[model samples]
Target: MLDHEVNRFNGIEIEAAHAPEDPECFAGELAAALAAWEEAGRELVWLRVPIERAALIPVATAAGFRFHHSQEDYVMLVRRLRPDALVPHYATHYIGAGGVVLNSRGELLVVSERHRRSARPYYKLPGGALHPGEHLVDAVIREVREETGVHARFEALVCFRHWHGYRYGKSDIYFICRLTALSDEIIRDEREIEECLWMP
Candidate 1:
C-alpha cells in the first residue's frame, strides 16, 4: 500500500495498492483502500491497470467506480470526482483548427470565404488559424462565428491530420468534429462570409 496526500483544491489523503502477482489479493486491498478514502471525506480514488487485466473493471464497477475510455498507455478507473471539473490545457501547439457541423437532418455545414480567390474555389470546413495561447475549442468557436455568423458549441476532437510546408509553414491540421442542429433563424453577416449552406 502506498500512502500520499493531494492538496490541489481540497486536501485529501490517498492510499493506492497494486497487484503484480496475485489479482485476488489486490482486489481486496483496493476495496479496503476505497472504503478508507470515503470515510476520510475523499471524493476521488484513482486506479491504473494494464489493458490486459480488464477483469479488474468488474471489480471496480462493483465498488462504485466508473471506467473512462482513454487512448493512453494504461486504463484509468476512478471513483466519484467533482461534477464541474475544469478541462486541462493539454495541447502544446495549435497549427490550425476546424470541425464539421451536422444539422438535425444529418446535413454537413460548409462555408465560402470572401478572401479565397481561385479558379475552382472549392469549399472547406469552417475554421481558421489558431491564435497564441488559445485553446482549440475556443479558437474553433470564434472561427465559426466569424466565418459563418452563427454561434456554435464544440463537441469533441474527431481526427487530426499533419501537413508540412502547406500555406502556413509546418502545421498540424486538427479536424474537430462537432454536432450542432442549426435553427431556421440564421442571421448572416455578409462581411467576412460569402455564403453558408447545409449540404446533404
Candidate 2:
C-alpha cells in the first residue's frame, strides 16, 4: 500500500516519495489505498507526484485523480472521496504595491520598464510584487529603491486597484502608497527599468 499522511482536514496525502516506481505496482497500491481510506471515512485524497515520476500520472488519472495544481517540481492531484468534499484551493490572489514617491521639490518619481510589450514607453509608479512575508509598507519603499535609487519613507496609502484575470488566472490587488523621498539622486535599475526620473 502507498504510505500516506493525514492532513488537517482528515484527508490523505500520498507524497511523491512514497509512490511506487512501476506504474503497474502504483495502480494496485493506489486501489488498495483508496479502499482503505474509504473505510477509514476519509473525504478527500491528495496526491503529489514529482516530475521525475511523471509516468505515474496516467495511472493515477485512470484511478480517478484530477489535476488540482502544479508547481515547479511536482503536480498536485486530488480525488474527492465524498460527494461534497471540500478541497482547499491553491493561491488565488497576488498582492503588490506601487509607490507614489514625492520629493521635497514636489516632483514625482516614476519609471519606464525596459521590457515593455507596448509600443509607447510604459511609465508608471515604481513598484513590484511583494515577497512572501513582506509587509506592504516595506515592499513599497524597497521597490522605490530597487527600481530607482531613491530612499523613501511611507506616508499614507493613496489608493488601490483590484482586477481579475491577472497572471496565471489569479486576481491581483495593487496598493498605491504615498512615500516621501529622502534622497534626490536618480539611479535607475538597468535590468528591469529603462528610464527613471523625477517628473513634475
Candidate 3:
C-alpha cells in the first residue's frame, strides 16, 4: 500500500511524497491501495498533490478522486470508499475585526465605505478582515490603521457576532474591539473609504 496516515475515523490520508513519478505506476498503486482500503473498512480517503506533480491529477481523477480544495502550493482531493461515507467540508468561517477607537478628547473614529450596496452614506467603525494567523489584538489595530491611517492600541474585546450564510455561503465571525487612538490623523484609504473623521 502507498504511504498513508490513519485518523480517528475510518479514513486514510495518502502522502504526496510517496506518490510515484510515473502516471502508470501511480495508477497501478492507487487502484491496489483503494481495493485494500475497502477491504480494511476505510471509508474516506484524502490525497494532496503538490503543483509540481500536476501530471498525477488526471490519473487521480480517473480513479474517482474529486477536488476538495486548493492552495497556492497544492491541491487536495478526496474519495469516499463507501456509498454512505461522509467527508466534512473545508474551513467554513471567515474571520473579521472592527475597531472602536476613542481619542483622549473623547471623540470616536469612524468612516464611510467607498463602495456598498446602499447609495446613502453610512458611517461605521474603521476595521476589516483579519489575515491568516493574525491575533485579535493585532488584527483590530492593523485594520484601524489600514482603513483610516490612525494608529491605535487594543483596549478590550467589546463584542462579537457570528452569522450564517454570509458572503459565498460561508459563515463569518466578526470581532469588535475597543481601542485607544495613538494618532488622530484622518488619512483614509481612498480606494476603500469615502470619508473618515473623528466625531465627538
Candidate 4:
C-alpha cells in the first residue's frame, strides 16, 4: 500500500492493495492505514479499484468507505476522515439531462414513457441519459429532440437535483435545462415514448 499525500487538495490518495494476498488480511491493513491517516489529520481519502479487482470492494466497504463514482475501467471509493473535508463524496455518479421547453404559445412540453419498470407511467420533461463523452448541453438537446420530436434552443441551465440510491442503485445528477422551442411540430419515438403534449 502506498499513500500519495495531496496536502494541497486536503486529502490523501490511497491505492488498493494489489499484492495477490488474502482479502481478510488486506482488509485489516486497510483499516489500520485509515486510522493512521485520520491520526495524521488527513481529511479525505480516495481509492481507485479496478473492476477486475472487485474482491477489494468488501474490504473498503467494511472499513466504512462509500462509493464515489465509477468509469468504464474502475470504481472510485471515498472516505471522509474528518468533518472539514473540502470535497463531498458521491459514489457511482450518473448524469441525466432533461429539457424544460416552452413554445411561443406559452405552453410547456412534456412526455410519458412507453414502458417503464415502475407501477404506473410518469410524465416528465423530454430528456434521457447523456451519451458517453457527450456534453450536458448537447445531451439535453439530443434527448429533447429524440423524445419530443421538436428542435429547441437551450437558454440556460435551470436546475439540477442530486438523487441518492437512484435507478440501478446509482447516484444520479439530473439536469433540468431551460429551452425555447424553435418549431411547434411534435414528433416522438413511438417505441420508447408514449405521449408528448403541450401543457399549461
Q: Please, what is the whole-model Cα lDDT of each candidate in the order they appear?
A: 0.64, 0.92, 0.91, 0.83
Q: Residues 114-138, candidate 4, lDDT per residue (tens digit)?
A: 8777868778899888887899999
Q: Residues 1-200, candidate 2: write the lDDT tens digits.
A: 68889988989998866778999999999999898898889999999999999999999899999999998999999999987999888889899999989999999999999988898996899999999899999999999999999999999998899999998789999999999999999888999999998999
Question: Which tens-of-lDDT digit does each residue in 1-200 have in candidate 1?
Answer: 53446657543333233453355665686677666666666666656556666666676677776654344555666666544433233343446778687767777778776777875566778887788778778888778766776566778788878766565343466656584744423454487667777789
Candidate 4 steric clashes: 5
What's the lDDT for residue 196 in model 1? 78
Which parts of model 1 have CA positions greater than 4 angstroms off? 1-94, 182-184
Models, CA RMSD each: 15.7, 1.9, 2.1, 5.3
Name the best candidate (by lDDT).
Answer: 2
191: Cα error in model 1, Å: 3.6
Using all chains and alpha carbons, the TM-scores for the candidates as numbered come to 0.47, 0.89, 0.88, 0.57
Clashes within 3 Å, all models in order: 0, 0, 0, 5
Instruction: Output the worst ten-in-a-row residue range by lDDT, candidate 3.
Output: 14-23
Q: lDDT tens digits, residues 1-200, model 3?
A: 68899989979998676789888999999999999999989998899999899889898899999999898989999999997998898999999999889999999998999987799999999888889998888999988998899999888998899999988899999999999999987788999999999988
TM-score-based ranking, best first? 2, 3, 4, 1
Candidate no. 1 TM-score: 0.47
